[model samples]
Target: MTTVAHTPPSGTRHTVADDIAGVCEAARTHRAYGEEHSTLHPQVWEALRSSPLPRAALPKHCGGLEWGAPHIVEAVRVVAAADPSAGWAAAIHAPAGAFLARLDPPLAKELCPPSETAVAAPVIGGSSVPAGTTAPAGDRMRLQGRWPLVTSAPQLTLAALAARTEEGTRWWLVPGTELRVEDDWDAVGLRGSASHSVSCDTLVPAGHSVCLTDPARIDGALYRFPLYGLMAACIAAVAEATAERALEAFAALAQTARPRHATGSLAHLPAAQEHYAAASARLSAASAFMREAAGQAWHDAVRGQVENAARARLRAAGAHLAATSAEVCQSVFEAAGAAGLYRSSPLEGCWRDAAVASRHALVAAHGRRLAGAQMLTGSAGGHL
Candidate 1:
């Protein structure tokens, strides 16, 4: 398998922002192909694999960037703005590296060696919800199950799948090559994410599994951040960025599109102007709230003082962002009139992508309910 070099040449430093820019450029260059083909563009995947964005949440000891939550959120935002599909993939796969910290040091180091030539930390993809069953087999576990909605399934080197054991639910780290990838994803939006179903009926060593509720062996601020919270924030960023792109596309269309029986172009219509202004304001407010929540959570993580209230706020902000962004996209699509109905229109694609993103488990209405329950009763039923 080919691997992307994580280290730059001698004396040439590559910042996280630079890597993010490169990924964004690649996403723009191949967005159309990915959208049409219903799979991630190879070049876009390569660019993302080589970039530090995927390693932003990894531990520094594992040669990861270990970026703060706010930075990670911003990186997803920029990439999503360039192409919503690429951004969705990034949001799903970026936090995967942090899971390695839960494994024993020896196995973690072996899987992701701390060397310049080692493959960029493997993109781990799988569902957290348990859909499989596991049984004890000597020093290993006999695993059999199928997980759905696995983003970038074909590209993943490892899968972090959850399975129900005799004891309880446990996460297993299985090699992607050992799993059967079913090309079953045919979603209307995020077509390029390759969120297919993966099934495996094989034995996995005991060392490859971890109970996520346990403390991570390798301690760090990034690892300290709540996994669900981070996932929600990243998902929210993609939704907000996609909405921003939709608004931009609408602006461009308004400048030239003349509605059927209108006095002038769409831009001159009072109703169109009102819709654009309202959508823009909604997006701006949602973006600010997301950033503020992410920043505060990161601040608490750095000090090793993260509170339940902070996590709840961050999750709430993410849910709010997803809902608001989807609303903004809907408003823009409606205001674009017949122009947005065409497949060639970027606004149309944005609307579709936002509609799908808003349905993600982390950013959906359930997330808000979880946050509200936590805030109101100081208990989320241990869901988070």
Candidate 2:
């Protein structure tokens, strides 16, 4: 499964999709190293650099593929099945690109060059930004805030910061050099994700900013999507892939790793068999649910039918997928018995990753309630 990226001759263009398999293979082979570094393996990062996957959701004029939402979700789900950290890291690109699409063309081009990569961290709960008394100077604004859970901060060239101004909430693109990343990403799972807090105290040109929910400057179906729903789909993709990996790993382990005092392999055990079947069925259903929701959302957006109720349905689908995937991972872990408990076992990693990812704000328990409320009340004005 080992694959390495190669250099194309000058003038030969390369895209993220070109490196997808190599990245997945590298991530799969170097999962332990990624966990140790609390970030993607260097090789995986390099592979992603040559990939077009990151900007898949952006308009073609911006060097993106303008992929449908369903396509992006499934691609992310497949990647996550290899390495959740890679999956999680890659999934952020769509939303990041979606935001980038709203920026003025020249600025978007300058900030998001074809070779450049960026990640985002929204200001959540409390504000860490210092209050400024002066208005932004022309096209430049100074920022001073700490954003937590910024994935892949070490590998990115830019970061999208969700901030507050006197006018309202907005998003700004800040160069990586202007921000400080703290090594505080230690967590129980998905340790490979360098999801540390980043502090910024620098000026960014006004061209690099946009209203958070403004109609995208680029006309396309992807730009029509609500940021919340896109984010939910991204996180759900990770959960779905991790669950799939756990089930596959457990099935493989059962073929050879017999239970204590068992006559045959664990695969023959009634309990293991039941667990495998049940978990597989559950994961399949969740995968279908997630894809369907994304597909429907994409369909509506393409036809200009995107509404709060539809967005709510998509969010609920993402949450359900996350919750269901976590359950499947747990089932697989329990079925593996003691063999699944060790750090050496992939099952342990899968379970940990699924558990942690399920808690992400995009797919948390509150999302389910919000979706229900939106559907019942026919309004989008609620917790996001």
Candidate 3:
């Protein structure tokens, strides 16, 4: 089910359409295997690096699509719908596109050579947070830190990390040769994310590093994209997919579902009908909003029409819509009742995956509120 990225149009013409469709189809294969592919199947991780979605959303200047968050919004939803773990993989791919591309052109060139594959697992390891950096040497940063909860740390070739200093905030690009992976990404749902701990004690060459919060203003719109927005949109998108699967399953159940001591089938029940209908409506709404919002942001970013304020608005909207969509999709599971509780049904997986995925720190109660609060306070969402 793996495929290459479609050739992009001269500007932002028509390539994203085909690229998104392909990401949707490819993620399904990973979804089919779910967590089994994590420790058991290294091939799944390998496929992800070579997959189109990661490359599709990359920075255009650095051999990437430069689609901004909109690109992520479309693809992540499809991937999450198939597998939450895979969705996370794609979510961070934007970092590869955004931060990685911002490195000195030659550094970017060295980090990911033309014929070689590169992996990045970021851990901000200051106390419990993945927030520390290696001391800067003459040309290379002398790496000496360990970041836990790094996804794919076990296999990553590079580490994208942020560290605070006396002067300002900084980020760097370190090689896997400088890292040590510690198996720590053990979770209930996205266990396959390969999110673990990593230790580094090597030098990150000057050409391969950049201070994301440096004096220079980097113009990659994807860097301006919101983590919460990207994460939420992906969940919302998956919810839409799950809703579709649930509806189809519910429809079949409607024709044949029968309960004891009941006069007619579950579908005949007014309550069941209402709940299913509502769930379906929510699913459709979420998908539509996701598409519209994502498309608008990406298109605007490419055209230089969206500034930080506009981008924040889009991020806030994406987070809210994603949160609402998750809620709506959960209703479908409720409507499905005990029969829809089949262990193997896609509905069940959708419920668990969406619930756990939505619970990401970015979309949590506080983070969601913060986004709204930022908008009201005239503050940009987090950092630019």
Candidate 4:
């Protein structure tokens, strides 16, 4: 099997921003192809794989920068500002190695040898029931089940499957080839995310399965906070990026759009100015709120403190930002008038991306409710 490679083909210093810009520049010309193929262009994928963008949150020993949630969120925002699909992919795939960092030493060594770079795709939402029947076969178990919404499934080297069994829920690390892609991720936005259904009927070694340990037990600062809270913040960052793009696109168009009765451009029109200012204010407020929430979460994590209520509050802030960003995107699109309706316009894509991203379960209505209930009861609300 081919191992995940980390060496960049070019000899140069590359930061997260540089990697994001490269992908954006490449993807900007391939939006039509991405829409048609339902995946990022091959060049864009290659650029992503060759960069250090994937292991941003893993421990230093595991080849990550060991940065906290805020850095990851910022990187995601920069990427999504240019290409929403690539931004979403970065948000999902970058911190994946952190999951393995929580594994036992022996298992972690066997699966992610220090000499190898590993790419793991987390299957977020799927049936809790056993995906496929499992039978003991020598040192391994034969398992079969279908999982959905496996982000970046095509580029993965390993799959982290949360399988339900009579014993309880267990984590299964299966090889990417062992799973078959169903090619059914036909979403209206984030088309290049490679979110597809995967069915597996293969032998997974017993050593590859383990009961998930509590994040608090992990020694890394990245695991100090609740996982969902960090994830929600990153998701909110993407929405913020979408809003920023929409607002910029609208501002550019407004400088030239002239109404029939107006002697000047839309920028001089009272209604247009009001719409632009309102949307800009909304985006700024939401962005500031998300950053503040993420900053608090990171500071607490670095101090090795687990403040559940604060984490819940962060999730709430994230949801609010997501919703607010969506509103900003819609407002900017409306401000674009007929131009926004065209598929060729960036406003249309930004609006679509915001609509889909804001609805992610982490930032959806339920997440807000969970945060609210937790705040009201002074509880952690682990359900999130």
| Most TM-score-accurate candidate | 1
Residues 263-310 of candidate 4 have per-residue lDDT tens digits of: 998788888889999888877877777767777777788897757777
Q: What is the Cα-based TM-score of model 2?
A: 0.85
Q: List, residue by residue over 124-204, the lDDT tens digit for candidate 1.
A: 767887998987799888899999998888988888899887767878888888889998888989888888999999898
Q: Which ten residues in a row have the lowest lDDT in candidate 4?
A: 119-128
How many Å off is the CA of 120 in candidate 3? 13
lDDT score, candidate 1, position 305: 58
My TM-score estimates for the predictions, one after another, are 0.93, 0.85, 0.78, 0.86
Per-candidate local distance difference test = 0.82, 0.74, 0.57, 0.72
- Model with the higher lDDT, candidate 2 or 3: 2
- Cand. 2 Cα-lDDT: 0.74
lDDT of 2 at 288: 76
RMSD of 4: 5.4
Clashes of 2: 6
Q: Between which residue pairs do clashes occur in model 3?
A: 58-66, 107-207, 124-130, 124-131, 125-130, 125-131, 151-195, 152-194
Cα deviation of 174 in candidate 2 (Å)?
A: 0.8
